[model samples]
Target: MTPVLYLDFDGVLHPADVRVTASEPKRPRVYNGGSTNHPLLEHAPLLERILAPFADVKIVLSTSWVRVLGYEYTMQQLPAALRERVVGTIWQGELLQHPPRTRYDAIQSDANNRGVTRWLALDDDTEGWPDEQRYALIAPNNFWYGLAQPGVADELSQALALLCAGKPLESRLPQETHVPSTVERIFGLG
Candidate 1:
């Protein structure tokens, strides 16, 4: 079976805009994002590259942004032809108000209803999954205002391979420890 792929906006697919915009009601040099067409929009080709190995996968979006706005707005970032390839969507309206225990559950529920298994989720906020099952690709900083680097999508693809083989994905940066040993380290954590 082709795995189901859960697509997210924000850091996973879209990059946070670090630039200040004139339309802002207040400040300058402030950034905004998780919405589509941020600079990370340049990275979308990564999605097509990552999903290529899966023969029958279905694409499902788990982004709350879509629900907050709507398809019309979301589609603005894509070329007309690219938008046509999207198959199914789960809007923010379809979700429970409190973030759930499984972003996987959200995706899995959609996959189950569609009778799909072998799924992959790409998310910035994986509020739905418990700590142990955080097997999907989670942005390292755990913040919404960043972007995935180029290799990340490849690692996510590798993780899907690992999961299908009944193995867990080790940190792609296994040698890189994130925890800080001192309070001074905490200051630079972001």
Candidate 2:
């Protein structure tokens, strides 16, 4: 089965925001949806419930959540089992230094790592991408420009349905995809 490349957390797994308080300097902040009333965390028991149908599928957490919230902090919030299913993650930290090019590069890298020829990305940002090709431009319920989340959402069934039928981008743009042979280095595939 092909992997489902999930990117948006608010639409695919959680409510988009949760309050988290920390001491020291005394700060109250919001998390990237996963617990309490948040979509994915609220329905933690439903991860398998939702994924059992796609047992052959694999998941790639291509979110900036790891960078913002930190890897350990996010994984600890998972409901044990789902935490194990994740093959890996791609944090768009430095990518943020760039713009649309960064987003495009990260997606391509994630796809390559998973050996994904076909996948879908549930993101609110479709800045430089085309709608006719790969990845879904699914907008989340309450998506923030720079925040990140780590699961599927409750209200994105239609988008997910489209993702189920999604295809990969075949863009000829130099910035959209990077085939190894096209790289300047010659150590291996490049």
Candidate 3:
């Protein structure tokens, strides 16, 4: 079975602390992102290089951008190398009208519907992911810094290899500790 990589754009492709413009958002000054171009396109080469060896590996969009830009447009935004590897997105058009409780559940629902067993997810947010599913996630440094962090790419590469081998993907960093409810944020009640 071809391995599927669930990719997030905001934090995975570029830093989450980015500025949005009418044309294209401005990416923050990343530490080692290879390029200082648009945030979305800057880290394309890095992802390309990491997945180059795994030719059969496919990418499934797990980013909120898919809801706004649509799959075709989002695919077009990716680097040529990464674009060719994209199969589809986790968020189907209709589902956008009614999002799941968590990002992990959304991806899992899509993967299950597609019968995709061998898969991995890379993102900065791991909120709502159960412990078992957390094992497959390669959480980024933080929202502000992504693969720019030292050793991030190496860690991602290693995680990819392990996921491809069907081995458990343990979290090196702490899991999403806790996610407060919307009411808590709104009313300041825990």
Candidate 4:
């Protein structure tokens, strides 16, 4: 089975908090209170580099951007290399149901429907995820750095390597504990 990667755009591809003005909807601005000087999709090349050797891996969109920006427009934002790997999305165009499902639930349902046993989710919303399945989640610090967070790229590469090898994901790498600096605390990036 080809390894599947559920990709979240806001946090995983770029900074989490992106704002767009009606005058310039095409160009979104990221404000982290000057904590980091990274551009939109600044970490995309890193992701592209990591996935370069794993040619069989497929990507599934799991970001809310699809709902807000539309699927085609959202896909267009990705670099050509990453965009080509996109196979589908988690949003099935269903009407909003009462008591919205969490990211884990959506990913689980999508995986099950597709019979995908080898899959991982790179997301920031660390809510409603069961303890046992935590290994499948690569959550970046969305409030601040997102994928640009130190050690995140390495962890992602390691996880992808393990996944492509058909190894059990339970042996996931340990996450480095991050203590926010004074500036980060002031900006609420911690």
The prediction achieving the highest lDDT against the true structure is 4
Query: What lDDT tens digits, residue by residue, belong to model 4 across residues 45-155?
Result: 888998999999999998877766677888998999999999988876452232247989888888988899999999998899998899999999745677878888888
**Candidate number with the higher TM-score (1 or 4):** 4
Candidate 1 C-alpha lDDT tens digits along 15-46: 53323345741221224533333354555766
The TM-score ranking, best first, is 4, 3, 1, 2
Judged by TM-score, which candidate is best? 4
| lDDT against true structure, model 3 | 0.77
TM-score, one value per model? 0.60, 0.54, 0.76, 0.81
In model 2, what lDDT does residue 142 have?
A: 44
Flag clash pairs in model 3: none
Q: Model 2: residues >4 Å from true position, as ranges?
A: 10-12, 17-40, 43-47, 92-104, 134-137, 142-190
Relative to the unseen true structure, what is the C-alpha lDDT of residue 155 in candidate 2, on a scale of 0 to 100? Answer: 27
Q: What is the C-alpha RMSD of each candidate to the true structure, in Å?
A: 9.3, 12.8, 9.6, 9.8
Worst 10 residues of 1 by lDDT: 25-34
Error of 3 at 14 (Å): 1.0
Could you give the candidate ranking by lDDT, starting with the highest? Answer: 4, 3, 1, 2
Task: Give lDDT: candidate 4, residue 101.
Answer: 70
